[model samples]
Target: METCGSMSPYWVKLNASNCFIGIINNVDCPENTTGLESSTVNLQLTAFAFMITQIPFSVVFGLALQDTENTFLLLCGGCSILVFLLFPISGILAFAGCMLILRDYPDLERGWSFDLCLASSILILIEIIITLIVTTVMGIRSSKRKSNGKPEESVEGKGSSKDGDTQTQSNSYGHSIMKFAQVAITNGAEAAKNAIGMK
Candidate 1:
């Protein structure tokens, strides 16, 4: 970045490899002795490191989802929590680091590297949101299936119980009718014999 201040062209440049910001002035430029703090640079570097590490981790996670065995998928699920936490945190840290860098060096312009990192952080955040939504939907669907299955089983059981009760009631009614008929027949025969003897 260059700025013309009525006398000389001031230039600001960043060296990413060495983590240095350099300023150049052709005529009558004030010297700034203060340099970027080590902690700020470390924070920025850590963010990039995490972004890099997530690449292989993400690939493995995708592969684990396709695996038929539950062990790998279960392990990935535990590790995924940590990965999810780190992504947003790292992105925020990177953004904070860039802001601090710009604050300390007002002449510096955010270059292509900053733009790229910003874009990457945004994309990663979006991916995280999508992943969460899908996981939640899948969980809700599975719960629905389980709930639906239980009611069907209960309904079948109720139908079977009703049928059994109807069968038992019919059998008892038939036995009671037969016992009544037998008692009436015996009383009639006795009354007839008594009448004949009296006559």
Candidate 2:
């Protein structure tokens, strides 16, 4: 979470500098500007963070479409944590490492930033897919459990202090799955928020 706090100011500085530099470069450029000059900051890219903006929204989508079972929800949570780690690293690298990359190709910083975002996007896409499959399987298993005379209630029932009959009656198959799913999502969201410094 400290990473997020530290990176926020850098992000602001990077953007402000990029904008200020860009305006100065454009205004200073001679009238017929056919190509980017050496002084031009073409490598500036807050664009790479474009995909990053989709993350919180994507998690919401995942929660809506993903399986709410313990395993799958865990998967989603794990994915979110991974993103939490990678998000800051990639952003900081893209923003702060610009000078290092400038030694190579001109405007290479933008390319590097784009590449980082692309890699992160690929990982996130895989996470979303796995979550979808796991969720579907969970839904199917839940349906099967419901149709059977004895539902999958042992674990949930054991946790409760209620009497045998009351526990059995209260924890219906659908209810159990929904409850666990809600819990899993909530925990995962909390973890992600904490990691992102959203909380």
Candidate 3:
């Protein structure tokens, strides 16, 4: 990276060896190079990994607390709670350490814990998107399957009830037509008689 990058003493100027050394030893720059914080900065990044990875541990601790009959489980859960409380202090330390590392360095990386944090964040986002897609698909299918699901008999299905409805409608229509024809015929006869001056 240092070879590829322009020749200045920034993060991008780091070589591959420096990455391994800086990340492992928690140093911000190469051994000879005076970049950022002291050597212990890398160790502090362990906090980042824990921060991203401890969700399941929190659940486990909660479950452990529920085990009333098991003394060992209770002890473990209590310790876990203690650790959880301590996590913030640890984060503060890591933040301070990271700030020290970042104080001079312009870019991220050369930090091992950052990798874990980034990876976990991306994984969570992907999981959420997939979950939402599946849920939406299922919901749509369920609603379509559930809504307006009357039996075939309700909508001109081949059942006695459907047949009855159709028959009733046709019969009423026929009756109306017959009555109208009768009225028309009676009016025509009356008009013809009147034209000839009959009562």
lDDT of 2 by residue, 34-94 (tens): 3222331232333234335447946754784567556756656666655555544444434
- Candidate 3 lDDT (Cα, whole model)? 0.55
Query: Ten residues in a row with the worst lDDT in model 3?
Result: 1-10
Q: What is the C-alpha lDDT profile of model 3 across 102-187, one tens digit per residue?
A: 55555544443443333444454465568679999999999977665755435545577777889999999999999999999999
Q: Would you list the clashing residue pairs of candidate 2?
A: 67-135
Better of 1 and 3 by TM-score: 1
Rank candidates by TM-score, best first.
1, 3, 2
Runs with alpha carbons beyond 4 Å of true place in candidate 1: 1-36, 122-199
Off by over 4 Å in 2: 1-110, 150-199
| Residue pairs with backbone atoms closer than 3 Å in model 1 (clashes) | none
TM-score of each: 0.45, 0.26, 0.34
The CA lDDT of each predicted structure is: 0.62, 0.47, 0.55
lDDT tens digits, residue span 31-114, model 1: 553334566556666776766667778887887888897788888856865785787777776666656666766765544444
For model 3, the stretches where C-alpha displacement exceeds 4 angstroms are: 1-12, 15-21, 25-36, 39-63, 66-70, 106-199
lDDT at residue 141 of model 3 (Cα atoms): 90
Model 1 TM-score relative to the real fold: 0.45
Model 2: lDDT equals 0.47
